[model samples]
Target: MELTINVDETTRNGSLLFKAARTNDTGAMKKLLESSDVDPFIRGNLEETILHTALLNDNKDVMEVIVEMVPSLINEPMTSEMYKGETPLHIAILKQDINMVHYLLQHGADPIHARAIGSCFIPGPYGQCYYGEYVLSFAACLENEEIVTLLLKHGAPLQAQDSLGNTVLHVLVLQPDKEMACFMYDIVTSFVTNKQKHKVQSIENSNGYTPLKLAAAEGDTQMFNYLVQKQKRTYWTMGTISYCVYDLTHIDTWGDHKSVLDIITSSKKMQVRKLVDIRPVKELLHHKWKTFGLKYFMLWMISYIAYTSIFTAVCLYRPLKRMPDNQTDNFTVMIQKTLAESYRTKGDYIRLSGELFTIVGAVVILASEVPYLARIGPRNFFGNASIGGPFPLLMVAFSFSIFIAVIFRLLGMEQESIPLSVALIIGWCNTIYFARGFRMLGQFSIMIQKIIFGDLLQWCCLLFISIIAFSSALYILFQTLDLTNYPYFRDFQMTLYTAVELMMGLIDFPIPYNNVTPSFIYIVYVLYMIFAYLLMLNLLIAMMDDTYWRVAQEREELWKVQIAATILLLEKRIPKFLRHRSGVPGITLGFNDDDKWYFGVEEIIPEEKGKIQAGGIHMAKSVGWEVIRSNLARIANMKEYTESTPF
Candidate 1:
């Protein structure tokens, strides 16, 4: 009675069960599926499950019977012996059977459960587990999105990375289908919401590439634009300005210290480069003016004198003008008193008049010299020199004139004195405009090749400077021509005037002007006040913004260097035992086969070398490794490898 099943008998029994299921023999398949005497997860010779064989053969009746008999087996882990451990679900997905996938999903098959098939037969590396085979890769391999959606709805993690480090979004970015990518986004959103957890929006692959970066690298402009806009709004709060500050020890979500902005800026792709170059031109202009010119000199002088004169005049004259004369003041005493008051007033007026004359004198000198300096003729009016040579001299003269005017105006001049204050303010304003114009022209000279005929970046910078200069000059001229009388100027002046008057109306004083209407004088005063305030404030703010961005860019570069260093360190520190086994013929060097072996370190090092250590062997080895790794990693990670490989 010691009956034992032989190998032949076992094989025959399994074959009979698989054949019955494949041929839609529901009665036999159900008997086999419900048999307690057999292993429910068993597979036949083709490494196919009875259920998998039924699905492959399109035996819907057998599949339905199996599902009805053992619903738990619908999501059961397949036996390890069949097809090197691939689950029944994996087999159905690989066969491209939408109906089988739907049935399996409906019956509770886990799409996210990965099985480890042999490396020789697996689409990716051995032990590779993707989110689901239903997601297409870059090769346009077909996948069922509807089924994937169903799995995702049932609590599947869309952001779960495969062995190759690609999420559903990552895979969709590689595909050419727009609808697929949008659908993937929706699925990911649902996964996030369902899980009540926030996944990293920009997850990198094994090769350290985010979905956006991949799109950018592939030149998928439409997808790249959409992702950038979406991410920027979501993460950066739609701020028009952004800065990347780098620290050597600061690691990003990808375990590197390099800033995303830096990576984008240095990318060889033109689109990424263009996006990173969108810096604020106004800020740069502020830094340039502050660092390299007479602009600051003029500004300092104007501020110092304007503040001192306005303050001193108000303090000294306010109480005196309001004082009353006593009856004790006799005719001679009254006359003497009157004479003294007139003398004091006349002295104040004379001092202001002198300052006004000095400012006007400087303006006249500058206007006269500009024509001479700008004139290009055989006879050198400014001397035997090119226009370039005398240009600097004119700038110096303009700067000096501004200094002189500012100094005189600060000597306690009254704000209400029409002739002197008007002349002085107008002259200083003109000088500022001329100086700025000349400086800009000089900048144009230096960057002429770039601005007029070179790349778009320089052209843009030039265009920005031109716009600012033109607008500022127009404003100055508008003030000078007494055009506040015109409807447009009146309206323009009113906006700024109204704002200022509302803020400082209580402290304001009346101007002494009989010829010009009070309304016209009021408009002129408001125009100057607003112009000075806005110009100075805006320029300061711009300078600060430029400095911040410059520092940020520098920091970003440093961070990148640190990241590269860390990677190099890791590469070097990789124990020889753990290094990738070389498959190349001959010498068993761990280095990539295509790497050029050079004797000099300078030719191969990943980093810069000192004066004396440029040709060291260690540098050469390190550089060779970096070059080889970068190239090979890209090739090894590409989707083409999976499609082209026999596996």
Candidate 2:
């Protein structure tokens, strides 16, 4: 007899209308809807409406009654935190109830504007696979083409993006399996007009990832290929001379100034094969080199030359400190040198100028490292001790060496020679960093780097241990025998040198029948030779060979990574205005209508056209403006003739 549903009672067992809808009880639902006290808009558990409960129960008759009597409740969404923003239509799609979905759509259930902003739809722990906010986006995420079609038929916009700015295509690309994404891509693109399709595909999410770039970033090569194939062409091909034009904006830099090269190279999930082998990316890199990379690379080379030249000149021109005869009195010489007031006579302008330049150069070089340290972070720059890489640290070391030499020179000490020698060695060795500009040199440098860091480092450790073990044993054994006869084993220092000489075959075997020398010493020497020369040396060769082969496989990727880092670093150093002026712009090919290629403009040299095909190899030599204009004119005329003549 009490028609009004209590809130507590509703929380426990849902409202009377919701209960009736759950059972598909048509008569009880009719009585509930008729009762003025029973509000049709009341929500039960999870703040689900009567329509949502009906759809959950598949109560078709109850849903039909509620739609007619309480039309306002049709689009009413769940108010519960997790399930909020989910209307009856969104629920029906989730339920996979086609008839109910259609019936709700026929009435007033909105499919286009209705968005589900529930916790489950958002990108978080609640749901790893974000279905997006819009109803159509949800259907596309489910991979239900039929339900998606139904939503589209009811005026659901494919161009509509969710709260995250991801369209249906963007969501599809995020799915683990890209097959459904490709299928949905074709379906969705077909559903929209040409203009709308472009907008839908190119729409960037909050992270600046267009669906295509997202696929590339995700390493979904199949999905990326599909998207590329679909969008790379603006029109159908015709005639014998068909042309293919590419959209640079689709493949090049997008979202946060990241290039296609940047995305693939920096992605931890992307395989090295994908980074080096992808055709478009390879082309993009080539375009970059031709456009701005060559100039920047040359500038870096000039800077390096200037840098190394300054240090080399300083070390060469630095005046040597004169010492007195009877240099054997090293303590007296050191004391004399320490007491000397002036390093230079103050008359040697050459030494003075050299020291001044050296100081300036060292300071300049040290200051230059600040940019690199800031970019890579001081932690990584100084922390990484790979002798082959860490270009910044190498420069830092070189600068400090010069500084040490300069300080010693100022103090009238000969100690500057040691640091000067070190600085020269490091400065020249650092030239390998510039070798990345050339492919062959870059590969060779990487191989050498791998060998030194990998095989050679381990070999040095083993060699050191072998020398220490053998030298110590030989010293102890031969220490008791020698009275200046065999000076090689007279002490630990001499014995250690002897161990090295023996390994190098400098010392002959079998000491001239000295009975005082323990027979056990010969046994130790033999074992040392066998372990060090026979086993360890061969093992070192094998390890080097293995490292060489391994590096050969990854040669291109490593080289490209080096080059990419250089290119990015160079870009950062350029003044923002000049850099923007040199920025890659949208290139519009004259023959390819008005669709601009936002990547790079390619030019073919007219004089080089004959040389384009030589020795059975067709080289795509895009160079000079004349060739591009010539090709464009020929293609345009051919297209015009083909169109006028008809099939």
Candidate 3:
């Protein structure tokens, strides 16, 4: 009797075993394997043997038939192109098929297979990284506890290293995904032995980065803590920390000018520091943030003076002496009493608090800035513009007006400025003072500085020179014209102001001269318009456009430096108790930056290192002036600014 098994036409490229497996036909698979003519171990173009094909397709029935028929084929490594030298067991692991892997291992498959059937490699920064999902790494990558345990039970190599020297534990520790890290942690603590685990943990990749080091560099603080704690390493001794802190670019693992610590610490973000549990680093960052809040609060309080003074002067202003029992017909007086008087409205305490707040803010700002005003001039203070600025002047003005009008309770004055209307003269000054605070950021600071100072300064000089040359000729020529009634040509200041207005298009076009003016005066006016509008104005516009793009390109570096300055300024203010404790079991890391801070033995290089004046609110500009904020751009490396520094 003969057994007939009809295989599908898709078996041309694959074996009958794979075709039957795809269809889940156990009968056909069994018949084909039992027949004498068909070889159970025959391979296709990709070197996928019948057993390999069955495993690849997740065909349970075909896989079962092949395993029973050809026991020798189970562990046979292929010689084909795609998965050369990898056996069927490796194929099962790649598929992450727990049941197939269990069946294969039970049916004489080797457990310690390093070459997983379809494992991959990717080009890293240095060279090829073992990025493939192989055996234990495949199970670990999937975060599959059951498959991992099953593999471990069947004696899979726990210390298996990939081509790039990444151990199974290395693969596990580097995964930033929380679930994967948790599973990897569980595998290390439970499955791997202490001796074997330490050996694998110490294995460094070709780039000389260990698993914990890679985790730290990746800024996966959770993974870093778990792996580092297991190694009994602390903040100071961790490879990632030391590599970053020491600026060890000499080492193979130091990938850039920045270390892992630099990348982590230099970040302006608070959340990055909050997520990690690295002993003293978190404390150090906390102090920086605390100082930031304190500085901002102090500045806000100063600005609040201007706000409250103007608010209360208009809303709560009143004559200290009661209104006279006199005028009944004065309707204007009645309206002023009803609307502008504090007692004339809802709540008295709120208005009183507002007035008091303004006075207190004024006093505080004056106390802080008055002594240093001689050294740090008003221009410098306003241009540092962020924390230290001419906000004091506005506060002082508002406070003086309030005191002069109603007379402060502390002062002995009765009636000085009288109506308090004098204080409201510069009420709009508060908006300018407050608005400049937002300009501390590099984006706005650079853009506004370039436009106002760089381009505007140049344009003003050109306009002044042009107006002088053209206005003089006209003024001398029209000396005899009847310009007595018209102030436009009678006085030089008036002529200058009118000329500026004309240049700015505020005056009529086509040169409006007095009817008595000479004909040569009209020629001078035509030449003036041609030069000012046609050439000079367009030149100014082009120059401003150029300045905008140039500053925009540098905004990122400027921002980084600005952020670093603020942190360095405040980080030094942290006392001993605020820093890491010395007596702990781990080594204490001290943070300092070139005598800027005396706190610690370890220091991070500031983003604007050696660029700012060490101990003052002064950034170093041209001529090494301590406080003068100037946009003197040294154009030495302007062309090379965008080029990569090949180290």
Candidate 4:
């Protein structure tokens, strides 16, 4: 049964033949192919040929027929002006058609061909084409191991380098799969050994780094250990000691570099020598003593003075008023009663006075301890019990004094107010002193801890102190005014106290002010609170944000170093043809004005090419009033400025 082929002569006009090929009309397609009048490779205006159209549509049958009819078409190089110089094979690879790949390869398709072999593949229809390599690289990235192996086995050139001089091994190393990495390692190793006839020594990538360096930078303990021990025992020995040291510093920058190194070194019992020979142990100890001793001594003296004063005041005054003698007890009682009366009349004054005294006392004490604290590492601030550290103990004593004062205020005991007030004064002193001395201490603590308190704990503590102080003052006020007889006064006092306490509690818990209060007083209070909160929050957020950003930036730098290391390892494994160049490896890809890739050494685009380039301001020349009026009149005549489109 002979099939009669009906020819469409108009198929050759523009994209008619391409459209027919895309549609896979075998009879019409065959008629067009058999007709010598029609150029089998006639491309559309967009440079899309019949084969390209067929490949774009994934029409395997049409492609097969075209290749079979004109075998010469398989060898003809299409200008990138059409399909960017990508052959039918390149299109098939880009389309990820394994069947088409097999067919094209069988029909003399060159897998190793590159549109722009040494430069970044440009995506235009008539520029450089490296679609096949990119497609393969992407496939490897997706962990399609079978397809990768198939492409390699079918003369896909395992050693084929990209514009960046990156081989398949480099791409595989970048894959986020441990299994894939291991598989790639095995395949690459096997290929290298078989091809080179000797075990691979060093494998540097386009970035002048070996695979070992990449693994080290990545903190990939298993891969690093395997490469160092299994592949080349001297791999780690080849680099300068400074380089190794730099690598070690970067370890903490990436994921748990220290931990990874610990695992590997411990397992292998590797003895890591110091990058440089340091001073003798005794010398180091002597130097430390000389440097820190005087500072510690001064701090101790200062701490002693502050501690002694507060301790003396609390002990002496507290016991004196409680003595057995009625004269002393009466005198003390009178003094406390007068102070309470004063506090009731002027609450802000009392609070301010207490705060001032506390701050002054704390400053004197902390100033003394500063020398000692500064000598120690900042992280030691949080460590349990300093061997000779008086700061922690002094802090505890100061806190206790404040606590006692709070109790006395709450009890409304007349004699106790003296000691209570003293304690409150000292507490503020201690807080201010510690804050001033430990300028870097907070940052160091956060860096080491990486905790985000969001000001919750600090605010809570402040709120608690404020509420207690206010409540005690209010209670004393009610008693002084003798408002117990007036029900409204009693109710109002209790209600205001509760509401203020609630506000204080809400503030401490970091609840939004708007959520807690609706009244004008509260609204004003909230506005003030928010202003203060924002001021403090801005400082705190700036500190924490800077710390976080610095850490992240450091980690990124470490990762790049690790990538360089891994590339080095691969370089030693691959052949000379697959290796990267000396200076900036040929594979270093950078962005253009449009964020597209470009070859050659990367340089930052001029500001004019950036998304938001700066331009000189254009100031209009000043016109006289008459001139302006004339211009306005002329413009007004152009169109009526209606209400809908008012000029």
What value of lDDT does candidate 2 attain over all alpha carbons?
0.68
lDDT of 1 by residue, 463-534 (tens): 345434433433454465454353333344543343344324343523223435445446655554455345
| Highest-scoring model, lDDT | 2
Top candidate by TM-score = 2
What TM-score fits each model?
0.36, 0.65, 0.39, 0.35
Please list the C-alpha lDDT of all candidates, in the order they appear.
Answer: 0.44, 0.68, 0.53, 0.43
Off by over 4 Å in 3: 1-14, 24-31, 34-36, 77-87, 94-96, 117-132, 173-176, 225-280, 284-647
Instruction: Give candidate 3's TM-score.
Output: 0.39
lDDT of 3 at 41: 65
Instruction: Supply the TM-score for candidate 2.
Output: 0.65
What overall lDDT, based on C-alpha atoms, would model 3 receive against the true structure?
A: 0.53
- Candidate 4 structure quality by residue, lDDT tens digits, 529-589: 4543454446556766765776454433222222222222233323444332221111111
**Distance from true location, Cα of 583 in model 1, Å:** 49
TM-score for predicted model 1 compared with the true structure: 0.36
Residue-by-residue lDDT tens digits, candidate 2, 432-533: 777888888888776766677667887899899989998898888876775476766767887888788788777675366645666797799899989877
Between candidates 2 and 3, the TM-score winner: 2
Q: How many Å off is the CA of 423 in candidate 2?
A: 4.9
Candidate 1 displacement at residue 525 in angstroms: 91
